[model samples]
Target: MTILNSQHILKNLQELKSFWQDFLPHLNDRCILLMSGDVGAGKTTSVQMIAGELGMRDVQSPSFAIHLRYENAEGKAMDHLDLYRLKDDDDLESSGFWDLFAQKNSLIIIEWANRLDFDYLPLNWQRIEVRFEKLSDTERKITTRQV
Candidate 1:
């Protein structure tokens, strides 16, 4: 299902939280989530809520560090990666991007993922696309696959 706004994504997260187990029965290790969206499209905000659902405390975006690795008290590490600067940083592929896929209990969320080459991304990964309507603050849409 494709949610048409930030609030819609929030609602869907809550709705899907309880039923998450059903969605991924054998889910284990190194999950990848590619979240594509324009600036201020709630990409970071959605990740924060997912972290909250996973019992992660104090979620923060690593847009500056290029990547963030945060593990809550539960030892579940969520890597929030910002590809916003990747357009210029051509050496990112060799700088530990591939290393993250080898980790267990790691969930990576790549914002502005469209900039990266598809070959660098994992196959069969979950994808989400966010679009804005016109040029307004409240105009946005989020579409997901294999959620």
Candidate 2:
């Protein structure tokens, strides 16, 4: 079931931060954020802002590494994953993507999520899909909907 649907046109970093600050509170403790966008569409930037809000520092894209894990002082785990290089289920299996579902109190943020097959996701998981569209050099239109 859908729980939230919204869109924001952010012209600068400050506006993006403001949007995240207002939207973060509505998320569940254990949720999966599936993000889709072209290169430089602000997908990773949005994750960084959200991590900063959660007291995480130096959040970086895991494009080459595939995945990075962060834990807040409160013991909340955030898994950042980049699936841009992964081509199929075999890659996902090798990357241990399914194992993340066993973790508790986790917020999983996946970039290039359109590469993932949603049918394989556990039924109990709360998934929020976010799409980022670059409007110009400094502007992005981010749309989100829960599924």
Candidate 3:
């Protein structure tokens, strides 16, 4: 389901979080969430919310670490990857992200995902685009491409 041109992101966020909790139970493992948005578009904020919902206390951007693997109280690990520093395709190639894809039961949220080529994406991924609009600080347009 794709949400296009939303006026209120906080409301949309409530819905998005609900969508995850309501449907994610059936998946029984990890899922890739490709957040296609520019800086300050709430991608990191959304992921932080997810981490909290998953029972994690801290959620920080791994801009320097490249990736940060967080574990739930139940031992489930969520991998958060930041591609903001990657200058070229070769940087992505060196990341060996494909091997990381093999890790099941782990959620991967990629920042600056649009910077990477589609060929590197997993077969199953939820693409989310957030566009800021209007003078209102809280309004945004979000489009989701779910496969």
Candidate 4:
């Protein structure tokens, strides 16, 4: 079943962390979280919150390196990927994109997912589309839906 489809007005980091705490457990084992928004829209910060919930304390945007992998104490892995540097499908393929997606027991959070071709998305895998809207300097209107 779909976990979240509502919008939240997050005014601070605590609220954001709470949001992830409330939502992360409900995510599927092989979740593909498509995070989309403009630059500095808190996409990476949201992933950081997810990582924190997953017991990965040190989290950062993988924009430069393109991908980051973390594992919790229980061995639940989380792959954080940034596709902003990829030009097209071929670029993604050449960068071992499919290999990353093949990983199991992991929640893959993709920043700048809108830049990637949606047609390549696997049909059977669980997917969530998270869109962030900057409501103010300190507030973000975040929405989620199953895909």
What lDDT score belongs to each candidate, Candidate 1 first? 0.61, 0.88, 0.65, 0.83
- Give the count of colliding residue pairs in each prediction: 0, 0, 0, 0
TM-score of 1: 0.68
Candidates 2 and 4 compared by lDDT, better number: 2
The TM-score values for the models, in the order shown, are 0.68, 0.94, 0.74, 0.91
lDDT of 2 by residue, 24-67 (tens): 88888779999999999999989999999999988998988888
For candidate 3, write residues 41-124 as lDDT tens digits.
Answer: 677877787888789877999887777889888998788888888777677667767777777557777877777666656665
Misplaced by over 4 Å in model 2 are 1-3
lDDT by residue for model 4 (28-130), tens: 7888999998887789888988887778878888777787889888898888889888767777677676887677667889998889766788866788889
Alpha carbon lDDT at 44, candidate 1: 79
Query: lDDT score of model 2?
Result: 0.88
Of candidates 3 and 2, the better by TM-score: 2
- Which window of ten consecutive residues has the lowest lDDT sum in model 1? 1-10
Report how far off residue 59 is in candidate 3 (Å): 1.0
What overall lDDT, based on C-alpha atoms, would model 1 receive against the true structure?
0.61
* Candidate achieving higher lDDT, 3 or 4: 4
Residues 52-107 of candidate 1: C-alpha lDDT, one tens digit per residue: 76777777877767787788887888888887877565546644677787765577
Quote the RMSD, in angstroms, for model 2. Answer: 1.8
> In terms of TM-score, how similar is model 4 to the real structure?
0.91
